[model samples]
Target: MRKVLLPTIIFIATILLVIRLFYLQVIDDTLKLKSDNNAIKINYDYPERGYIYDRNGNLLVANQPSYDIMVIPKDVKEIDTSEFCTLLKITKEDFLKKIAKAKVYSPRLPSVFLSQLNKKEYAAFQEIERKFAGFYIQKRSLRDYQVPCGANVFGFITQVNDKIISKNKYYNSGDLIGRQGVEESYEEILRGIKGVKYIQKDKYNREIGSYKEGRFDTIAVQGKDINLTLDAELQKYGEELMINKRGGIVAIEPKTGEILALVTAPSYDPAILVGRQRSKNYTMLYHDSIAKPLYDRGLLAQYPPGSPFKILTGLVALQVKAIDENTSIICNHGFSFAPGRFMRCHCHGGVIQLHRGIYESCNTFFSTSYMRTLDKFSDPSVGVDVWSKHLKTFGLGEFMGYDLPTGRKGNIPTSKTYNKVYKGWRWSSKTIVSNAIGQGEVLMTPMQLANMMATVANRGFYFTPHIVRKIKGQIIDKKFTTKHKTTINRRYFETMISGLFDVYNFGTAHGLNVDGIDICGKTGTAENFTKVDGKRVQLKDHSIFVAFAPKDNPKIAIAILVENGGFGATIAGPIASLMIEKYIKHKITRKDLETRILAKDLQPEYNRFISKPIRDTLINTKVTIKEKAVVTIKDTSGIKKRTALKP
Candidate 1:
């Protein structure tokens, strides 16, 4: 019986082992595929990135062929290193370093050794690539800009860093990623899936045929193309008008909340960030601390919203029942808070109500109204918080959640904010009355100001402003479609709108109005000051203007800011008026205004504000002229890097 039991146990064990072998060989192929890796060479096929078109179907960005030289460290064979370096126009030290980096990344996987080779270089390399084992050419696409504008809107692509590679497993070494702007915001939708092919190789590492007849291979899916809401022609015109200026301009469609044109001065051509020259050109642009061309002032720079803020003050007062349309405040040329601490107004001494006060930009009137709104509550903190809530509903004092990658939470001083500054509830409505005139801790981005005007046009509601209108075969995110109602009731906006309309007809901006357009606008002149050698020094004022055209059913809402440009009417008003006319009329009838703007270069005014050493250095280096030439030529060849491949 013992002998029979031992034999039966052995038989059962043998049957179990046979079943396991059959299951592994037939059903589970994962281990088998790993074992077969030694005889299979994998190749990646990158798909063309999606194209970008303006709202009018004008192509803004398209793909151009680019080739990269990739290397597998484990497959490398000894060859003439000098000859290879000379062919690639790289030094032996660089070649060695790249090879070391590739080995560290992965001994068997491919890494980019030399990237962005031009057509001439590609032809030269193709003739001799067979001599270099372990290296192959991989095809990819780089952006080919159709226009020289919108550098801040259409950001560039760059190779992924170690941080990105670690965070996203989908990306490998030497992969390109969007850096900023629309490209960065929609990276996933723009960068298509990479297809992989497994080639069977012999024991000698020679390619023989496809592995398993390509059963495991994938087909690359092309990226979905996107249409931006921007008007390319208007954008170009705005950029042209803003030349030699330092500020930001944002235009939004009032009905849809689509950004029509976003222009930032001192911007470079988008092409400057493309190809192998990107790093060098980026360094040059980045080092220019004065201009800061990389900085998107439209979405990033926060400044005092100036008189455009007075409009909000009026609205908040009306919403809180602190003021009515017929409510009148007298201006003795200023509102005297204390014996010497008076908030001055440029409007001639007179009694004024809401509409005339707005058109005249009466500082006294707005300040008195602001005081009433804040003084309504016994505790100034409660009043300040209430006022802040009303302002935030207009998309001020916070990140507006626009589609851009960068923005500032412009300050809307709450009771809590002042508590930190004043250390208690020691402040009152009169103590912080400068806020009534858009001074004192209140700040806003140009985009936010434009959106505020859009909200006014929409009568207390706005869709989140976005650059993208649609993606081919896919709907845009629902956030852009949702309407955000402001804290003020819709009925209150009518009074504010009427006041704004009077700004064009009888206010400071009356002379700058377009002929056929019924424009509603506010002009602002913010007092500028800076520290020079640790002492406050007064500089030229910052000009600001915000407006919407065809007031009844507004089509375009825009905000323009010009640093050190004097009164709002001097520069920003004309620019805003021209921009509105360009978008609505599709042609500029004010050629005289256009010529004056084009002929004027405000570098001298900017120079006066800069420190002597930096100003002298800039002059000695001729950096401004070089930068201007860089924009005009759009030639990246002067940049020190491998030439990019052409399509």
Candidate 2:
């Protein structure tokens, strides 16, 4: 019995070993992967990035071949450093630093030693390709801008950093990443999946096909193309008009909430930030505090909405039943919420209704309406909150959730905001009356201002503003398609629209009317102030304008802000008119306005603003800071000085 048991155990053990060997060799394939790891070399095949096109199918950005010098530190062999440095047009110190960085990143993994090599540089390096043991050339696709404009819209590509590598497992050391604009907003969709291959080395040192006979290899899937809502012609025209001016212009389609034209003045050619020159050009743009070409003023720069904010004030008043179309507030050149606290108005003294108030931009009428809105409520805090909530439906007071990466949540004050400011004091609507005419604590981006007009044009609802119009073979996010209705009723917009229409016909922007287009607009002169040597001083007013054309079923809604450009009717108004005419008619009948804008150079104003020397503030003496820090700063008599404790 013992001998029979021993024979049976041996036979069972032999059968189990055979079954396991068969599973590992054929059915499992796990050991095959591990077996190839030591003898196989892996390589990646990167695909071409998706092309960028405008709504009209005009190509905006395409791809160009780029080369990166990659190194695997572990595979490096001692060679003549002098010859290698000369071949790559790099100094010895640069080479050493790059190699050290690569080693620190990973000794076995590949890292970018020198990247974005030009054609000339690539040709020079090809001669010494054989001498370099660890290094190899990697081909990549870099952005080649079809047009010179829209740097802010197209954005740019750059290499991944250590921070990014640690967060995203898919990205290695040498991979490129998108930075801003459409490039950044849709990076995952635009950057297609990269394919990889593995080649095995036989014991005889001969190269063989990949594991599983190339079945494991994948074909690169090209990135999906996208269409932007931007009208190339309109974008180009707006940018040309903004030459020498420091400002932001945002235009949107009222019906769809599609961004038509986004212009940031003092911009650079997108081509400059491509290829090998990207780093140097970016550094220059970053340091230029005056123009700030890299800054997206349309989305980032926040300023007081000025008179255009009266539109929201009027809408909220009507929604809360504080004021009606027939609501009249008499103006005696200005308004007085409290004695000695006079709110000045340019309107002549008379019975001012909502229509006359908007066109004339009468401070008294709107301030009264604003006060009535809060005064109707039991608590000023609750009333102010209600008023603020009404405005937010117009896409103000928060990030509008646009497709772009960078933006500011333009300030919209509520009960909480004032609660912090006044603490427990019993504050009245009069204390915050300055908010009625778009001044006070209210701030908005040019994009937000444009979106407000879009909401008005849509008759109290707005689709979230977006740059992407279509993604190939896929629908856009439902949020962009979803209509957001304002707290105000639809009936209120017509009355507001009528007042805005009259702004072109009989008011401040009368001179800015296009011949055929029934343009509706509001001109604004926001009081610009900043701190100089710790003293707040007023600079020349920032010119602001908001408009939507056709008066009914409006096609375009636009807002613009020109820093230190005085009256809105002068600079911002004309630019708005030109943009509207150019977009609707496809030609500029008002060539005179275009010529004046083209010839006008605000560089002198910019120079003077930038030329102000900023120095340390000393006690009992006058000190000067830069213009943005103080603008037209002359008075420092009451300014505070920072005094450090004596050592």
lDDT of 1 by residue, 447-514 (tens): 99999999999999999999999899999989998999998988778888888898888889877877
Q: Would you list the clashing residue pairs of candidate 1?
A: none
Off by over 4 Å in 1: 1-25, 609-613, 620-647
> What does the lDDT read for residue 342 in candidate 1?
80
Off by over 4 Å in 2: 1-38, 202-206, 609-647
Residue by residue across 1-647, what tens digits does model 2's lDDT show? 99899999999999999999989887987567766665666678888889999999999999999889899887788878999997877799999999999999988778999998888888788778878888888889999899978989988989989999999987888898888999999998899888878777687534587766776688778888999999999998888888778899999999898999999976778887887767865765675454577889999999999999999999889989999999888999999889898888888769999999999899999999999999989999889989988887787889989899999998999988888999978789999999998899999999999999988888888899999999898899999989898888889989999899999888998777889899999999999987767789788889999999888879999999998888899899999999999999999988888898787766555444332232222122231221111111222455332211000
Best by TM-score: 1
Mind sharing the TM-score for model 1?
0.92
RMSD of each candidate relative to the true structure: 5.8, 7.5
